[model samples]
Target: MKTIRQVSMLQFTLMVSAFQISVAFLSLPRELARQAGTDGWIAIFFGWGMATLASAALVKVMKNNPDGTILDLLQRYMGVWASKIAAFIFTAYYLLLAYDGFMIATLVIKLWLLPSTYIYVLVLLLLIPTFQIAQHGFQAIGRYSEIVTLLSIWIPFVYLSTLRHAHWLYLLPVIKEGWLPVLSTIKIMVYPMLGIGLVFFLYPYLVRKDKALRAMVISNTLTCLVYLGITLVCYVYFSPDEIAEYNEPVISIMKSIEFQFIERVEVLFIAFYLFVFSCIWIPSMHLVSMNSAWLLGKGPERGHLALWCFAVAVSFFIYRPSFIDAARVNNFLNLAGFVMEFALPACLLLYVAIIRKVRGEKRS
Candidate 1:
């Protein structure tokens, strides 16, 4: 095993926070509106609560086995064969997640910015840096995440400030329909919270210091606030019907803006979003590399193999002749993600807790 140093808790928190806001800010508002009607933001809050609890449970599991990956701890508690099965399932989930991220980015690029270019080329261009960063190990990834966390804060403020032209009446009659739709929207809203799973793969690397849980909770709370703010702005600025009509509500919201200096805000938004995507892509690539290294028992250098494999596979899978097919794959991956990221962690935590209690009773 490669000797991985523990990183600052601050870095860990920032990475988690940045990852949470990036993907959700892009497509979530429109998706939520589709599922929950006008009360989509309500479902967002509900999902936020659910995600927080999930995050806490994940952290607790990490605490129980400090300096251990979920795979490592599972083996300790659930026997080697069972742990191998669980690890395989979890790895498959993350691979799908990585594919979804790549597909979403490719779709956005093809749809809005670069209609003439090939998608595989774009995926390769992005993946090169992602692979390089992951090879630098956890510290580099943490530092990069800290820098992007600042950008994450600034991007939203820029978007929201431009929203002076927004129409608040679009958000009126909150829940014009019954609450059932809002409840149903919970599943839709929860998809973006997949970033919480980053902690499972990264937590063992965090330098545990005073109040580690506090730092993690604060990070989660700030991330939830950012998501809520973005979702609320999208709801209030564009009517539910308008949001449903647009494929990318954030881009559409930006397009609606015009300044004396700038003719098209979408271009500016895309430039910033590309940066955000890069930040997210790096850490995800790093996770894939780290996991692959552990699985293959080839030391840290093996991370490079995983990185290239992911980059190439993702590029091929996403850059299909039919962009529609790529999108269908992305949606199915997101649905699978909800189970892998949220449901699996919850189950693992419960299993560990029950095992601990049973062992304690046997000891007594």
Candidate 2:
């Protein structure tokens, strides 16, 4: 059957980039600093290489079952009950990811721009765009990702303005924290580079399947460069001690920029950043709905209110974490994300490859 909603190579790549690059923007540099200090960018490269291998494995598994997602492959190889169980677990994972983005974006806004606004109000405001894209399915989400990613070009330039205060000394004494800290940060970095695993859900919808892995590499590479650039800028622009003081060093760096034309450019930056941040939640919400729909042998249409409700219910309990609180939660999520996005996918690829080799031997 012809898939009616196939996404192009560019759109697929952009979607992955958008997802990897979004919510991580404000927190990533800070987290990297917390883990590895100024030597953090090295860890980013390590994480990027790790993500590259994981992405290739994910694409390979998808290539093996071109007509179906991992869920379908599980049913074919494992039992129906097992496949459904895996699907439910994956569905829950994406839902949790969606809510994570939702919570982070809301908290960022409350911290920076809309402190007077209620968390529930921010939740509703955020969900409006998320549901609009998710309900329309991957096509809309793809195009939205493309547009928002294009809009992200301005981010680098904004960060560039802060280089006026650049301190080459702060970034000096490379490996000052030793490789141990840098190595630890690799684990921290892996979680944010995780959006590549969405290939399981998105691969079947790719217009040109042959280019999917190539596009995955390109997306992840671009995201890696974006992280590297942001982290480097933060490392150079802020003192090592001062970097630790700010919760969101990327946004805090912007506060150093003073423009006669604009009163507080950081506020404007964070406000516009809400659009880029939406990239994470919108597509994730779609993944949750699509997984649920596919498991039931149904078309990938919308109206997945149950997942949205689950998100809202989660938000009530996860309400307005302090910087330390959010960091603790983020650390926990990163550990979980590493297991799901990298460890499990690598294992799945090995399992699928072995299954194929045995089948090929049988055929021979």
Candidate 3:
């Protein structure tokens, strides 16, 4: 087996964190309100707490098997037949997520900038460089992630400056629908933290010894806080009616900002958004490529091939014939994503814990 290059713990954390903030920050508030009404932010907090606990369990699984990826550990702990089934399911989920990332980028472009832009051309432009970086391996991707992380922090500051424009009165009458609505929204809120699952595949490749668990926990905690903050800000800024009416509430919030010299803040928002999209797309591409390479039992060259295949497949399949179909499909995919990303990891953690206990008792 050709060894994958090692990345630092900090790099791993930032790569995951930056990607989490990207798509979630742009659209989550709207999704939250649709599901949880006035108590959407509270649902987000609850979801984050659940996601954090699940992530910690996953990290424990990784730490127990220091040099093994989830696939490797699955095969060792379970039978070969069962492991193959699990691996295939996970691999499919990751590929779908990569495609979803591509689709989202194209969707944003079409909705906000150019209605007539070709999805394939946009996907091609984005993927070619991503393939090149994936070929360079994880270290290059990590460095790029670090740079984007610094830029991503500035986004919240920009959003925070728009607070004065937000209607604080909109956030009144908290949790009017009570606990049931808030609990229901957990499913939607937890989907944003799905990037945490990437750690199962990448943790074995980290350079730092025994720190993956701590790093991931800290990273996830910070991401959850950031997401909750952004969602709350949107909830307070826009009326429930206004939030439901807008597709991208954050961008709409930015549009509401104005000054004498700069006529539009949306342009600045788009530039930062492009940076975020890049951060999200590259790591997603990397995960798909690396996992595909592992599955095929091929050398590093196969990683390059995997990257191209993923990029091409997504570009072709993602362009819906109509905008309405695209929106419907995207919403369905987001809901499906909660299952693959959150529910699957939680199940895997449970499996691992059961196996460990069984093994311990047999030994005793």
Query: Could you arrange the candidates by TM-score from highest to lowest?
Result: 2, 1, 3
Cα RMSD of all models vs. native, in order, equals 2.8, 2.4, 2.8
Candidate topping TM-score: 2
Better of 1 and 3 by lDDT: 3
Q: Residue-wise lDDT of candidate 1 within 1-364, one digit each (tens)?
A: 3488777888887777776666557777788888886678887678767877877777777777777787788778887776667656755665655565666677688777888877787777777677766677678878888877766566666677757877777777877888998998887765566677877777777777345567767877787777678778888787667778877777877776677999987877786677666655667666666556556656664455465556566657654645476557556756876776778778887887788898884321
Worst 10 residues of 3 by lDDT: 319-328
TM-score-best of 1 and 2? 2
Estimate, for each residue in 152-196, the C-alpha lDDT of model 3 and write its tens digit.
677778778878877777877887877898888877765577677
Residue 55 C-alpha lDDT in model 2: 85
The TM-score that candidate 2 achieves is 0.93
Off by over 4 Å in 2: 295-300, 305-325, 361-364
lDDT per residue (tens digit) for residues 1-364 in model 2? 4455888999999989888887777778777888888888888889778988888888877777787878877877676998888878888788777777777887888988888987778887677767766787778888998888777778788788777778888888999967999997788886678688788888788889999889988998899889988988998987787787877888878777887899898899888888888888888887788777766767544656445645675575567555566666667768778887888888887787788787773321
TM-score preference between candidates 2 and 3, better one: 2
Q: State each model's CA lDDT, in order.
A: 0.71, 0.79, 0.73
Once fitted onto the true fold, the runs of candidate 3 whose alpha carbons sit more than 4 angstroms away are 299-336, 353-364
Compute the lDDT for candidate 1: 0.71
Worst 10 residues of 1 by lDDT: 300-309
